[model samples]
Target: MRLAETVTFGGSDLDRCAAERKDAATLARNLAEGGQVIVLWRGKPLVAGDPAKGACRLVRLGAEDPILRDAEEGAIFLGRIEGQAIFAMDISGWTPPEPVDEAQIGAFLDPTVQLHPGAPEGSAFRELRAIMTTLTARDAELAATARALGNWHLSHGFCSRCGVASAMTEGGWQRLCPDCGAHHFPRTDPVVIMLITRGERVLLGRSPGWPEGMFSLLAGFVEPGETIEAAVRREVFEETAVRVGRVDYLANQPWPFPASLMIGCRGEAISEEIAIDPAEIEAARWVTRSELLQVFAGEHPEIRPARRGAIAHFLLENWLADRLD
Candidate 1:
């Protein structure tokens, strides 16, 4: 796990200026001088060129960029790099030029890309998952932060405590209810995705609605009082009836598919039998390391590997190369 930070969305080293967020004057000055502003639309980030190519990258706009005027909310400070401040803004209020299929939009890694008339030439808004692996470490974190924070503000417009509408404050990091003295912060649900192994085979499962032949490491949310180790064991047992004996943390990635922290773990399975709960997963099976190699290469006949940017894929890649230690 020494190279944990190398995982997508984990190694950005963003200098999130926590103290400056509270200083109104300093924040205003930074916004005035900050030239790096990443734009998102309906949870999709704006990128330039063909993201499938190595040369493609994010197009972080200046603070004065007119496209940012359509942002439904205020600018969010996403830290800095080399003395230049970076910000993220969601222009979800703007509509795309073409009529989009509501069903295909992120239903399964949304293949549809959108272009705005005012956006930069060759720039288009695309689902972050589609372009996450192609982005630099910095852009990956920026997109994750933007999507997660924007989703939080959109879904949490009301105070849970008093059922009152809240206002964005603290540089879009905190929400304050005017009626009550309630304050809310962004939420990141911790999910444990375990690589369960028995001898040379690893446990894999496909959810009920996943695309055909898709399988991934078993995963579930960490309950309120459960530890990481306990969550891994419980989730594996619950989903596949596989009892995990020992669990160790492997790495973590900021999965902003609506704000999640994917905690990758390695678990030694004491049992090989898989009795998948139909309600939890559509199918469960064991695959050998050799089979995994085929799956990663897109040569496997039945199963495709997890998405490239996912923690599951990262863990599997390292495990295959004997770099998990």
Candidate 2:
């Protein structure tokens, strides 16, 4: 796991200026003084330029741009990159001149060439998952942060303590409820995605709705008051009826399909028997290292490898190469 952070969406060590988030004067000055902003529309990021050249461009606008006027809430500070202030704003209500391509709007597990439409003149609203592997570390992290924060704001407009609508505050980092005096921050659901290994094989499962032949490391959300290790063990048992022991931390990835932090781990499976819970997964099986190599090589007929940018793929790839240290 030494190279774990080198995974996609993992290496950008962006300086998230947490203390300055609440400072109105600093944020205003930053915005007015050459601060660049990333635009999010309905959770998708604005990308322009060619992805083949490692320039899957993240559309950035200045504070004076007219589009900033249409932002639904205050810009959320996304920290600075080499002294340049970065922020994210929501423009979900803006009307596009063209219609989005319906055929290109579904879930794609593998990276495919895409042509997006229905965006502003120069940019296209691209699904981050599709192009995550092609983006630079900086761009990937920024897009993930923007999408996660924006999705949280969209879903948590009301206070859970009272049935009162909350107002965006703290530079869009927090919401304030007028009636209940309750303050809410953005939430990131923690999920444990473990690489379960029993001797020479690893266990993988396919969800009910996934594309044919696609399988990935077993994962589940961490329940309330549960530790990461406990969650990993419980999730493995619940989904495939496989008892896991000796769980060890591997790495993590920011999965922004509505804001999740995937904690990757390696586990020792004590019980090889699998009784897949149909409600949780469609099927489960064990694959040897040679079989996994075939899957990655596109030679396996029964299983497609995990999505490229996902932590599951990262873990499995490293494990197969005997580099999961």
Candidate 3:
């Protein structure tokens, strides 16, 4: 797609300096010299006041602060945001004690804060790419990593191998069980979202809990020992009773909403007979190009486009622009 990277958290040209991992001293020095600082208090992101008025944009720090001390671990280099030294913190496996003192925290969240309640109303959170560029791009990515990893720690505190509590190790990347010494790492489940097309119509479905009129591309988690191609075919056929052929990968996005890597693909539907698995999808249908255009423009009262910043939206927008070949 021509605008694939334009998706939220999609288009970042940050210099992820991987070589600096071995040199802790050098990395710390570099971070200190960097201009913008992205802070996370506890697990939730600390937005500077709020984003509605846009008062707390990234700014040059006059001096060092307590948050930057030893805050780096499982933290990777995100790109520069407006000449400020923007950095992300990976606080996985570490939960903050209760009684959050609002005054002592920096913004802590993946780039998806705008979608949640209490964040400013009537604001856009789906265009992560747009919001990312407006703030610290690299810092946003790093914060996302931290949030994802931290969530994993919260859920996977007990070792699956021996059913014992695990401890954070390897700089927040791996968890070690004190009883069995089992090492666990954060997970990124692969999900395939395909824009299945048969001539002029494309396949779309609405899950049981989705908002009214909201539909998205057919998707499913890739099972163990399954290729992306096989997963797409199985998912489409199982969900909508459509036989898929000629699957082609389009793009990928790191969705850290609890940790997922969305794999976008284009598939050809060999059969069009719609017989949805009533348990999985509430409704499934074929949408023509013109109908999709109306939905995108909010002219169609019966259908709502997929959430922005998602791979489904990326595929749909590209399909509209004639770039999804």
Candidate 4:
């Protein structure tokens, strides 16, 4: 899509100094010396400061009013943000005040806390994706990293093999079992999201409980040992009874809502039969490029365009502009 990479978290070529992961002390010292500055508040990063100018603040743990922390407990050296060294701190342990109702979460969801220290944060912090355009590329990548690693710790606290509690290791990337000596690493499940086209028309589906009129590309999790092409075809067929052929990988996005890597593809539909799988989807149909254009423009009577920032939207926008090829 012409605006594919323009989505939230689209990416800004942030330096992710992966080569320095092994040297924690040097990296931490480098960060304290004021080279990089971008911190995440519940996964939303603060991109407003100038680290090289020493305009950033690092709140010590247990300090009076600290909004962020080192995300890995150890430093994960994020490359420079406009020539400043960016380091992410994981503050996943902090909990917020009790909520009286849903509206309370609104105050808790503000993005400014990323810039300010301790404007009241929460334990359920996640990667900041909604306001991606306003964030720097360094901040976006750090937020994604924080969300992915934190989720791994949450879901894999217990070992699958021995049913024992696992300890964080490898700078929060791996979990080690003390009882059985088993090693576990963070997981990123693969999902196939495809724009299935049959000439001028494409396939779209709406899952149960989504907003009315909302439709998106057919998607499903890739089965174990399955190839990307196979997963695309299988998911499309199983959901809508549409046989897809000639799958071509288009793009990919790292979705850290508990960790998923969306594999975007363009698939050619061999048949146009509509047989919705009741358990998986509520409705499926072929939508012409013209109709999709209307939906994108918010003029369609029955179907709404996919949510912004989602891979489906990216694919559809590109397809409509004849850029998906």
Candidate 5:
């Protein structure tokens, strides 16, 4: 897909200074010199303004900011933006003054516009997924990087090899285990999300607990020792008993709901018969181009289009418009 990277959260080419991450003294200096920080509370980013107008604001702070006093761990160096250093701090343990809104669509809620005890009054922790489509490319990339790296540090605090707790090192890029001398890096699980085509129809499936009428491309995690193409084929077969062939890579998106790399692909379906595995998916079906266009137009009563900002939606939209070249 020529315009593949134009997808939401796909195009920002931030200079992730990998080499600088290893220099503790430089990182400390950056912090001491008043580097800006992005704050994440319980995996939700602090937003400062309205998201509907394409200004999904990210709260940036300085090192001595009062909010950092209660940060759970040292800041993660997130690289430089326009010659200024960027960092991420997590204050997951801090209690919010207001109860979190549970009826929000995504994992976290857009906090009430009120003053927290120690934080800025206008800022509110909001789920990245809930506002991803509205954010600028830079904000989306930065938030995704922070959320992914932060989630890794939170979940992989223990060493997998020696069963020992690991300490954060290398500016939150690596973990060091004292007991086993093992070095652990942040993990990004690769998932294959493929659009399977048989003539004029594309395959889509719905999971068990998904909202009624919601469906998306068949996707599954890449198993160990499995190639991306192999994973795509395996996932399609496992979920819907649809045999896929001639797989081709399309585009990718950083899906930071607990850290995943969504590898988008297009696959040719050799067999049209769908024998859906009830355990893997609640339902599976193939829809024609016209029918999908209806779905996108909100005219299909039985199916809701894939959520915007997701790679699935991106792929399907491009495919419908014949732009997946």
Candidate 6:
């Protein structure tokens, strides 16, 4: 695999059985014959261990598990692993035993965990960001797939072309509008996250409402009629007024926080000066290579490295090691 493909949520090559999704008979056979099942709540995947500590992984359940009774809209076929058909279900309908921290549910990285009374021992629905790094490549891919697909179904129940409810077809891969014959597939918003470098320093910015000391590579959604290269330069300049000369694609990650594909890129910034747009970002600054090392080592007094398991952190680490090739 290429070094770029090693980024979290990228390397896994699970076999997504597209043809079988159309075969309802085959899908039923797989589930009846014991396919691997994954359960999700809201956007969180059911994980087995505490991610804050060591040794955490996604929890896979059997098809006949009682908790499947609470699954919303039945099962979603989430491709295959080796020879086993993997399926997922969003049991958002399942309520918890007690009250939950509503504030944390929508935070950037929700630290809160919810335990379902019907789930397996030690299994709880935890935020994917909170436990992404701890999951194996296959588990991470499955979790991301389940979260992205489930969320898409939640918001896109109605057809865009006609004002009518669309039914999920092709084993949850598509939504067909019964009224207008409009077929809508899952949506993955394309985003550009570029590492803008000027000499030995890298440009970093923090959003207005982000926690103190949290900074990452400048990113923005790719606008219509925009190429990846153009989007990279535009986002960097718009946020920091730093002009970028040459841009190259590096890696890509599937960020399932409301479904986005983060396209990682590296840009050579021609301007050293930073002019932050308050509306775009709260602060923008350049951090030296040496200072970045301190930030990663937790020795920097005022700066925090990008969150682990994110493409930004992966790109920065590779850059620091001189391995962005």
lDDT of each candidate versus the true structure? 0.88, 0.86, 0.66, 0.67, 0.87, 0.89
Model 4 spans > 4 angstroms off = 1-10, 35-65, 68-84, 98-117, 120-129
User: What TM-score does each of the candidates earn?
Assistant: 0.97, 0.92, 0.73, 0.78, 0.94, 0.97
RMSD of 3: 6.5
Q: What's the candidate order when arranged by decreasing lDDT?
A: 6, 1, 5, 2, 4, 3
The top-ranked prediction according to TM-score is 6
Residue pairs that clash (backbone atoms under 3 angstroms), model 5: none
Query: Cα lDDT for residue 181, model 5?
Result: 92
Q: Judged by TM-score relative to the true structure, which candidate is superior, 1 or 5?
A: 1
- Alpha-carbon error at 50 in model 3, in Å? 6.2
Worst 10 residues of 6 by lDDT: 1-10
- Candidate 6: segments with Cα more than 4 A from true spot: none
Against the correct fold, how does model 6 do in TM-score?
Answer: 0.97
Query: 1-325 in candidate 2: lDDT tens per residue?
Result: 7797888888586898888888988998998899999988777788886666756878898877776676778888999888889999988777665665545555553232333343346567667877788788989999999999999999998999997999988877899999989999998899999999999999999998688889999999999999999999999999999999899999998888878999999999999999999999999999999999999999998999998889999999999888988
- Candidate 1 structure, TM-score to reference: 0.97
**lDDT at position 228, candidate 4:** 99
Model 6 C-alpha lDDT per residue in residues 1-325, reported as the tens digit of each score: 1487777888586899788899988897898798878898898999898676755788888888898888768678988877888998888888888787788887877888788887889888888887888988888899998999999998998999987999988999999999999999998999999999999999999997677898899999999999999999999988989999999999899999889999999999988888988999999899999999999998999998899899999999999999987
lDDT of 3 at 113: 37
RMSD of each: 1.3, 2.6, 6.5, 5.8, 2.1, 1.3
lDDT, candidate 6, at 286: 93
Per-residue lDDT of model 5, residues 187-210, tens digit only: 889999999999999999998767
Candidate 1: the clashing residue pairs are none
Sorted by TM-score, highest first, which candidate order results? Answer: 6, 1, 5, 2, 4, 3
Error of 6 at 48 (Å): 0.7
- Residue-wise lDDT of candidate 4 within 26-136, one digit each (tens)? 656666676443344444343433433523222222221245443434444446656666544555455445332334324423322322334433222322544443344
Give per-residue lDDT, candidate 6, residue 266: 94
